[model samples]
Target: MRLDLGAIAKAGTSKANQTGSWRNFKPIFHQEKCIGCSLCKIYCPEGCVTMVEKKKYTVDYTYCKGCGICAEECSSSDIEMVMEEK
Candidate 1:
């Protein structure tokens, strides 16, 4: 019997995995406190952060792994890391 390796994965396949539950801590954005430095967007490993309007940024939690890189890179202390709820 020949092994059909070609049938393994289909093209443009989407994963059903949700990683938000894996986060120990979540980031809280303080929009008012943000200085529009773009540091959070620049440093985000997952590229979840996006610019909304003229220097303001918004984070998409769907792809965020809660690595805290955004919080660490925030020179204005705009992004705060808080523990995730069970």
Candidate 2:
């Protein structure tokens, strides 16, 4: 059998997994610094980031792995990675 890597059979599977509890860090979205570039939503590996409005977005902690990719990819320094309290 051949393994098909990087192939997503379905999307939005993270909603059922609730993997945020395993994260050691969390991303904080600072709207004031956001430039509406949508980088965070585009770069999020877990697909937990979603557009809130035309130029705004929000993170869903339920499935966010806190990998910090979104924060690192933000050009305007809108997202910040912080220690997860829980």
In candidate 1, what are the lDDT values of residues 1-86, reduced to their tens digit? Answer: 55586757556354345556578989988887788889899898766789998657888777677999988988888888999887
In candidate 1, which residue pairs get closer than 3 Å at backbone N, Cα or C atoms, i.e. clash? none
Clash counts for the predictions, in order: 0, 0
lDDT of 1 at 60: 79
What TM-score fits each model? 0.76, 0.80
**lDDT tens digits, residues 1-86, model 2?**
45568754567553677888889998899888788989899888887899998768899998888899999999898888999776
Error of 1 at 65 (Å): 1.0
The worst-scoring run of ten residues by lDDT in candidate 1 lies at 9-18
Worst 10 residues of 2 by lDDT: 6-15
Candidate 1 wrongly placed segments (more than 4 Å): 1-16
